[model samples]
Target: MKAAVLFETGKPLQVVDGVQIPELLQGQVLVDVHYSGLCHSQLAEVRGHRGEDRWVPHLLGHEAVGTVSAVGAGVSKVATGDKVVLGWIKGEGQDVPGARYPLVKDGKEYLLNSGGVTTFSEQTIASENRLVKLPDGMPDKLAVLLGCALPTGMGLVFNEAKLLPDALESQGKSIAVFGLGGVGLSALIAAYTTQPKVLIAIDVEAHKLELAKKLGATHTIDLSTENWQEALQAICPGGVDYSFEAGGKAETIEMAFEAVRDAGGQCIFASHPKEGEMIRLEPHAFHRGKSIRGSWGGGSQPDRDIPLFVELYKAGKLPNLELLLSHEYSLDEINQALDDLEARKITRALIKIAGE
Candidate 1:
């Protein structure tokens, strides 16, 4: 198998071929990866943003679409030849530890660490619970989004924000999505389904904000421009009913929290800032009924929510799934993909591991 090995933090991943797949432990499933989504989380890990790398020379990737080749004992969630969407979120099935692969380089043996699910390899060993069987006829590229971006973004709106359909239809209900990345755009697409009176998209990139408008943002604010917050306030008047921060920066998170209305507005941020950094907000804001919190993969349950998101996409509710994919790269070009992500040159990069 070919895999991108992260041998050290703050260094490019080494594309190593002829890597041996470890034996499947109990509750593990071997999968032939088809397509994997490159997320900012991986970038953080590679750049040493999350602190010391105890798991050096490990595999990194959380979302992908693959076909099950084999399953270990006690694995009932999937079978051989079944197509599945692999994710980091735990689902129904046995909870098992991650797999460790052994590889030899320059006549020396080294071990590679991996979580329950990783997609940076041509072949991967995923825990049974990390795999979700895909609906027949779903495209592998689109299914890849369900593993992370779609679920986390849509989940933030549907689950954490708890924005019911009726609530969205209510007159004067407004939403502000901070950072027009994959998750932010996904939140905008999902929030638009509710038909909120106001949908504001904020970002430093004009292209992303433009895309957000096409995806149903009623208003767009470029953070790079002066008085962008003033522009947002002019449109939203008394702040928004809800706000979502996906930029993974402390400043953006603080802005999202402050952009909510004083009473009954909610702010949710799925991005994790660098370790040792903190977000400071007005202490008196909480007393006014405004709330701010973090999200865990948008509080998604892979078995239940992934299917629902697919159904919605199938029904034309999510028209921008393909638009979210700005670029695609092969396993060997993984470093370039990460560079593009860090440069904000792409919304989401899809790593093609195998044929459709």
Candidate 2:
């Protein structure tokens, strides 16, 4: 099968021919990848920025939607020909929240499941337990996103921050989403469902801020200006009740804390760090009852959250297509997709592995 192979650090991806197909081992499944997304993690890997360039020879897909071609003898969650959405962190066994993935290497547990899916190839292998079956008729384009971006957004609000639907009306609190790309927009859409009292979004680009408004942000803050912090202060005078930093930068994560109300709000970090980079925190501010939490893949438990997003989208109540921005390229053109992602060109780029 064909796959994008990252040969070295700070370099473009080199396409390799006849990359061997991995096996359907214990708790694993083989998928004929239909669509794979270009996510930040893959870009970080291509640049060797994530310090995980070691998984180089492996495939480069994290968010993908495809059909089951076969499964290991013991698999039971899904069957051949079934449609599934592959999360970036695919692994075997039931991956309940708080379950420790045993694929820990060099001290850190590989946040992504070992035997689960990596979708960059024409065909891929995933742990059956890690894949989520979409209800029939969910468009492949939409299903592809639920695997990564959707959960990262929804899980942050509903899981990590625990934004209960019932709280929006009673609390009548405002929220801020500090990034307007894929994950940030996902946060906006999820926040829309709860109908927060006010939804403010921050982004360096004015166009994305405009897009955020269409996606449900009641207001937009342009962070490029010197007084952008004042803009943030203006809308959220008492500070927002909840803040999410989708940009994944230490500076933005720090800003979330600065934007939240005292003792009543929480800020969440949704982006993954490339290396061991650390973000500074205000210890004194945190002591005032403001909480900061680091979230992984939006704290998703696939079985429960995946279907929920799909069902909600199907009802036309959730914004799926609007939240996801997909630009498809063939397996050979994977480099172009990565380049576009690097340039911040595509919100969520998808690769057409096979079967249009």
Candidate 3:
């Protein structure tokens, strides 16, 4: 198998071929990856934003679509030859440890670390719980999004914020989505279904803002310009009913919190800042019924929520879901894909690991 190995922090991944696949432990499933979605979380790790990288020379990738090639002993959630969506979220299956591979390069032995699931390789040994069987005929590319971006973004709106159908039709309800990445755009798509009178999209990139408008944003704000907050305030004088932060920056998280109305407003941030960075907020805001919270994969249950999301997408509720995928790359071009994501040149980059 060929895998992109992260041998060091702040360095490009080393694409190594002829890598040996480790034997599957109990409750593990071997998958032949077809398409893998490069997420911001992986970028954060590569950039050393998440603190010390103890697991160097490891595989990285959490969302992908693949076919089950084999299952280890005691595994029954998915069978061989089953097309499935692989995610980091834990589902109904036996809990097991991650896989570790021993590779020899230039006569030097190195260990590769990985969680129960990783998708940045032609083949991966994922825990049984990380695999979700896909519906028949589901596009492999689209199903990749269901692993993380769709689940997390849609989960924030449907589960975390608990925005009811009536609230969206209330006319007074307003929503502001900060950052136009895959997760942010997914939130916008989900929020748009509610039909809020005021839907604001904020981003530093003009192209992302333009795309947001076409995807049902009533207003768009470019953060690169000065006084963007003032413009946002003008649109929602009392502040928006809800605000979402997906930029993975502390400053953006603060802005999302401040964009909400002082009373009965909720702010949710799915992205996390680098270690040692903190988001400051007014202590008095809590008294006014304003609250802020972090989301873990939008509190998604892979077994339940993914199927629901598929139904919504098929029903035309999530219009332009494909728009979230901006670029495609081969397994060897993984570094360029990461660069494009960091440069804001693409929303979500899909890496074609193997033919579907």
Give the top-scoring candidate (TM-score). 1
Ranking by TM-score: 1, 3, 2
lDDT of the candidates, in the order given: 0.90, 0.74, 0.90
Cα displacement (angstroms), candidate 1, residue 330, comes to 0.7
- Per-residue lDDT tens digits of candidate 3, residues 1-356? 89998999989999998788888889999999999999889998888888768989878999999999999999989999999999998988987888988889988988799988899999999999998899864589989999999889888888898764336344446999998899999999888887788999999999999999888899999999857679988999978999988988999999999899987999999997888998899989999989999999999999998888888777778878888888999999999999999888999999999875
Return the clash pairs for model 1, or none: none
Per-candidate TM vs. native?
0.98, 0.89, 0.97
Weakest 10 consecutive residues of candidate 2 by summed lDDT? 95-104
Query: What's the true lDDT of residue 94 in model 2?
Result: 48
Taking every candidate in turn, the Cα RMSD to the unseen true structure, in Å, is 1.2, 5.7, 1.5
User: Any runs in candidate 1 off by more than 4 Å, and if so which?
Assistant: 165-172
Off by over 4 Å in 2: 90-115, 165-171
lDDT per residue as tens, model 2, 242-332: 9988885777888887888887678887876657778887788877888888887888888888878877777876754644665778888
**What residue pairs clash in candidate 2, if any at all?**
50-274, 90-116, 116-126, 116-127
